[model samples]
Target: MTNRYRSVFDIIGPIMIGPSSSHTAGAVAIGHVANRLFHAPIKEVVVRYFESFAQTHRGHGTDYAIISGVLGFDPADRRVPLAVDLARRQGLKITFIEDQGLSPIGHPNTAAVTLINAEKEITVWGCSVGGGTIEIRKVDLNGLIFTPQGPLPILFVEANQPIGAALDQLFGENYRRPRVTHQLADHYIYQLDLLDRPFPEQIDQARGMSQDLTLL
Candidate 1:
């Protein structure tokens, strides 16, 4: 597992504008990362809640919190409370699905968010373990796990051809570790956890080498 908790405050909790860190703040963090993975203007969103989240999402303001993050608002942003209205004004459609039986063996506070636009669609599965901490379990049906550390550069690459050598040259020195997941055939998902932000030129170069790529 990737350790992101840098200080006592991270373990304690995040400073956020919500009642419960797990239900609200963590949901926001999950949505935020999902947005980054999508990396495009969102036309619609479908958020599926499971177990504990399915039971009390509305009362705990999890709906608003997740939508707020999808709109690119941070957990501490004041706009969280008005996410629904803001999304409406921005012409973004949202749909919520609650399923208690979807993943009985999975974490209690789990959510699967699907982001869609005209050209592409992406799905992210996340779990809130508590104290505003979250783990991204899967992306686009591939099992790739990692925690979203604040301001840490994360890169997602999908390609039909092998690009391991390119990746090694691009991130071997600066990244802590790289998680690669095989999709169908020769396709792959390269999830790179970087120590620092890469240059814009490097990002552009990566974009040229893959079928799809996103950075966060």
Candidate 2:
């Protein structure tokens, strides 16, 4: 029930250099998505692969896929093969773990990704739903089930007075409304569905955007 509708990318799969959609494309997207949750530059990352991904990740280019994504490469990029070396050059330290635990969601392709910066840390639990589609099940240990439809801007921030005032001033436009919002601990997570277009520059730089927000 996370995704109510399907986008074109769901059926055709993403344009990716893939050994498989679940292993390669999905892993990269997972890492990219995990990175998006952090406001600071990623310094270290830890990923745990489950089931099939845990067994064949290395041979299937899954490791490269994640590293490339953490470095902000999309699935279709040709530089995916060099992501590991590139990460080291960028001062990103990555750790991989193999976990055999059963998934509550019953998906074969699943990962628990933890990303860290100088001050903040974020963890995401997700699964690949085939054809490059993914489901984010949790964030910061709180259930946050959803599936992205397009190139939407996801915002994560603390739900406080300043954040509210800042967001009100920023999203006061006539056409914009949050597609969904979730409260997690002291923070709030939401996604701005752009409906097949790029995000506007104005809202991207809105007054409160940087106060306590992470725009994915």
Q: Please report the candidate that would top TM-score against the real structure.
A: 1
Model 1 lDDT per residue over 61-103, tens place = 9999899888889889988989988997899999999985865
| Highest lDDT scorer | 1
In model 1, which residue pairs have backbone atoms overlapping below 3 Å?
none
lDDT of 2 by residue, 1-216 (tens): 444125775777678997888788978887887877664688898988888778888898988888887788989898998998888888888899988787644578888788887677777777776777666655662345544333334455444333544554555552245545665556565544433333467555642444455554
Candidate 1: how large is its RMSD?
4.6
TM-scores of the candidates are 0.75, 0.71
Give the TM-score comparing model 1 with the true structure, all chains together.
0.75
Model 1 global lDDT (CA atoms, 0 to 1) = 0.79
Which runs in model 1 stand beyond 4 Å of their true positions? 1-6, 102-105, 141-154, 158-162, 169-178, 181-189, 193-216
Candidate 2: 10-residue stretch with minimal lDDT: 146-155
In each prediction, how many residue pairs overlap at the backbone (N, C-alpha, C within less than 3 A)?
Answer: 0, 0
